[model samples]
Target: MTTVYIADTGVFVRCGGPDKSKFQRLRRALQQAGVSLRIPQRVYQELGGNPAADKYPSGDIPYADGFEDGWIVVAEELDYANPLVSTVMDEVRRFIANETDRDEDIIEKADTALVGLAAQVLDTGEADHVVLLTTDKPAGRAAEALLPQHGFSDSIEFRYVSVAYLESLTADEFW
Candidate 1:
C-alpha cells in the first residue's frame, strides 16, 4: 500500500541548526527511500511565522532548501467541506485539547491540520496509509487513536521524531 509521510513543525525544529547534520541525515534518508514529507500548510506557516525562532539554532530552519529540492512539500489546503476531513479535524481538536489538558479553543488549527490532511489524503485516495512524524506527543497520540475509529485501522502510525530517532534515521525506516 502507498504510504504518505506527514511531518509537523516540531520534527523540523528537532533537527537542530548551524551544523545541520540531523537535517542532512533526514534529507538523505528520504532521498534514498525516494519518498518525501508532506507538511500541513499551517506547519509551513509555523516554521516561518515566528521571527523569535531565529534566535535559536534549532529554529534556524533551512526549510527553503527542502522546498527547493522537492523533498519537503506543503500539503494541499484542508478541505473543510469534505465531511470526513472536517469530522476528523474536529475530533483531533478535541483530542488534542484533552491530551494537553487545555480547553478546546486553546488548540490551534495547526494541531488539527495534521490529522485533517491525513484524513483528506485517505479519503481522496491520495494515500492508502499515513505515517505522522512529530514531536508533539498529544497531536501524535490523537492521530494514532482517532484515525482507526474512522475505518483506517492499522493504516495510521505516529512516529515520535525524537533526537535519537533522527540520529538513527535510514531509508529502511521508510520501507
Candidate 2:
C-alpha cells in the first residue's frame, strides 16, 4: 500500500531559524528514504503569508530549498466536491472545535485541510495510507480519532512533530 506523508505549516515553522541543523537533518532523512512531504496549499500559503513573522528568528527558514531539491511538493488542491473528502473535512472541523473547546466556526480551514487531503488521497486511490506530520494537537487528535471511523482504521496516523522528533529524525521513520 502506498503511504503519503502529509505535513502541516507548524512542521515547517518548527524547522525555521538561522540554525539549519534541524532542517538539514529532516532533509537528509527524507532524501535517504526517497520520500517527500506533501503540504496542502493552505500550508504553503501559511508558510509565506505571514509578514509579521518575518521579523522573528525562527521565521528565517530556507524552505524554498526543499521545493527546489524536490523534497517538498505542494499537494493538489482539496476536492471538496468529493463526498468523502467533504465529510471528513466537516468531521475534522467539528472534532477540532470540540477538542479545543472552541466554536466550530473558529477553527481554521488549514487544520481541516490536513484530514481532508488525507481523505481525498484515500478516496481517490492516490494512497492507501496517510501519515500526517503536524504540531497542532487538535488536528492531530481529530485525525487519529476520525479517520478510523471512515473505514480507515490503521490506515491513518498522526505524528506530532516535536523539537526532539525533528532533531533525531531518520530514514527509518519514513520506511
Candidate 3:
C-alpha cells in the first residue's frame, strides 16, 4: 500500500542549519528511502515566510538545499467539492480549536489542511494510507482521533515530528 507522508513546517525547522546532524540524518534517510516529504502550500509559504529568519544559524541554506535535493515538495491543491473532505475539515477545525483552546477564527484552514488533504486523498482513492508528520499537538491529535469515525479506519496515522523524531531517522522508517 502506498503511504502518503504529509509534513508540517516544524519538520524543516527542526532540521536546523545545513551542517547540523539532524539535517544530514533526515536528508540521508529520505534520499535512501526515495521518499519526498509533502508540505501544504501554506506550509511551503510559512517555511520561507519570514524574511528575518535568515539571521539565525538554524535558518537559510539547509531548507533551500532540501528543496534542491528533492526531499521537499508541495502538496496539490485541495478539492472543495469532496463532501467527506469538507465535513472532515470542519470537524478538524473545531477539534483543533477545542484542543488548543483557541477561538475558531484563530484556527485557519491550513491548520486543518494536513488532515483534510489526507481525508480527501483517501476519499478520492489517491492513496492507500496517510501518515501526517507534524509538531502541532492539537492538530496531530485531531487527525488521529477523528478520521476513523468517518470510516477511514486504520488508514490515517499522525506522527508527532518532534526534535528527536527525525533526528535519528533512517531508511528503515520508510520501508
Candidate 4:
C-alpha cells in the first residue's frame, strides 16, 4: 500500500532554522526513504504568510531547498467542488468547534484544511494510507477521529510533529 505523507507548517517550524541539524536530518531521512512531504495549500500559506514567523529561529525554513530537491511538494489545490471534500471539511469544522467548546463559526476552512485534504486524498483513492504530520492537536484529532468512520479505519495516522520527534526521526518513520 502506498503511504502518502502530509506535512503541516509545524513540521517545518519544528525543524528549526535552515542550518539546524534537525532540518538536515529530516531532509536526509525523507530522501533516504524516497518519499516527499505533501503540504496542503493552507499550510504553504501559513509557512509564508506570517512576517512575524520570520523572527523566530525555527521559522527560517530552507523549504526552497526541499522543493528544488523534490522531496517537498505543494499538493494540488483541495477540490472543494467534490462533495466528499466539502462534506468532510464541514464535519471537521463541527468536530473541532465541539472539541474546543467554541462556536462553529469560529472554526474556518483554513483551520480544517488539513483534515479536508486528507479526506479528499482518501476519497479520491490517491493514497492507500495517509499519515498526517502536524502539531495542531485539534485538527490532528479531528482527522484521526472522523476519517475512520468514513471507512478509513487503520488507514489514517497522525504524528504530532514535536521538536524531539523531528530530532529523532529516521527513514523508518516514513515506512
| Each model's total of backbone clashes | 0, 0, 0, 0
> Of models 1 and 4, which has the larger TM-score?
1
Candidate 4, residues 37-118, lDDT tens digits: the string is 9887777667763323432212534576786687887777789899878888899899989999999998855668888888
**How far does residue 85 in candidate 1 sit from its true spot (Å)?**
0.9
**What TM value does model 4 have?**
0.87
Supply the TM-score for candidate 2.
0.90
TM-score of each: 0.90, 0.90, 0.86, 0.87
Clash count in backbone of candidate 4: 0
Cα lDDT tens digits for candidate 2, 16-70 = 7425787888899999999999888777777763333332112434576787688
Candidate 3 segments exceeding 4 Å error: 49-62
Residue 137 error for model 1, in Å?
1.1
> Which ten residues in a row are the worst by lDDT in model 2?
49-58
Q: State the C-alpha lDDT per candidate.
A: 0.86, 0.85, 0.78, 0.81
How would you encode candidate 3's per-residue C-alpha lDDT over 14-80 as one tens digit per residue? 7776688887888898899999887776676677543334422133334777766778766666776
RMSD of each: 4.6, 4.6, 4.7, 4.7
What lDDT score is found at residue 41 in candidate 2? 75
Candidate 4 regions off by >4 Å? Answer: 49-62
